[model samples]
Target: MSTGFKCRNCGSNEIEEDNARGDRVCMNCGSVLEDSLIVSEVQFEEMGHGASAIGQFVSAESSGGATNYGYGKFQVGSGTESREVTIKKAKKDITLLCQQLQLTQHYADTALNFFKMALHRHLTRGRKSTHIYAACVYMTCRTEGTSHLLIDISDVQQICSYELGRTYLKLSHALCINIPSVDAFDYLICLLASQYLLERI
Candidate 1:
């Protein structure tokens, strides 16, 4: 009799049965499996789909798997698998900038949070993370009223301004929204408002 087993490595269920029948190896994932191990059909399918989704997310970044999310508690990977690799990469970048530029931790946190929020919004509407990250950084610098030029930010992020500009154009084209012109004066008004609100408290 032939029995089925799920691959622990790749979450693939179409494991082939060996002639010995004592043990099995997953053809898709190359994981060793035993007939005694039982996994629910739903769990196997979910883990498989999750792995595929994460793989897509990681490949979205231009840099090779520099964006690997640690495995999670799901059927195969570790707990961190639920989070996207791009999100973690953004956080690390923000932290590095804060350390190098001597910016306050609060500013770093705010920048990271804004990037996360913007990326999530655009992605849910069918945009890519890499495009969003580049845009988010530009928007962040503008919104924060930093004297640092766009070229400087691009250099620091190791993203070419030309590539980022092209991505911005594509994102704007896809979203059908104009990239609003950033005004340094407008940012000052925002900062003043924030200070006033703090004083009132």
Candidate 2:
């Protein structure tokens, strides 16, 4: 996440966060930089497509799935879960994943938007949320020119890389999002830099 906050004691950039303790500490000097980090619970599920009439009304002729309720219970990824529950789980998963991948907030938000689009278009039906969320994050990394590879997401999600790639391509085509070709050099640079950091540590 490349936070700009540095330790006052040792002026180190290597700060570790313990979410359980809500503490940001310097790895070099073992000094606490911030004792309180506000973890936000305001999630994407709260924003219910306000004022978008299109979000409310869908033609029964076009809608082939089971009927849903205003309370937000719907079919998603093979599970009949409420909108709040599904989106909340996705929100938490994406947040933790973005942090693990060191993706910026822009990329994270873009990924979440893509997931929302998928939900709108019913692309998530009969699919696994884990794969869908992985695909969203991978698509964000691809479209935003990030150096993260699809295999990275697969490793974290414990899914097959090819399956994840297929999900990503399906979501891209369904959302009509144009993903750019990856630059091998950027990935190489990222890998080398990661190796350097490991050696430094």
Which 10 consecutive positions of candidate 2 have the poorest summed lDDT? 50-59
- Model 1 regions lying over 4 Å from their true place: 1-78, 122-134, 168-201
Error of 1 at 85 (Å): 4.7
lDDT of each: 0.49, 0.65
RMSD of model 2 against the true structure: 16.8
lDDT tens string, model 1, 1-201? 125556676676765553212236554322346544332233223564452332222234434232434455433223333334555787777667656556566656555545544443454246444445545555455546666544555566676555555444444344333335645743443345445546756
User: What global local distance difference test value does model 2 have?
Assistant: 0.65
RMSD of each: 18.2, 16.8
Give the best candidate by TM-score.
2
For residue 77, what is the lDDT in candidate 2? 28
Q: In candidate 2, which residue pairs clash?
A: none
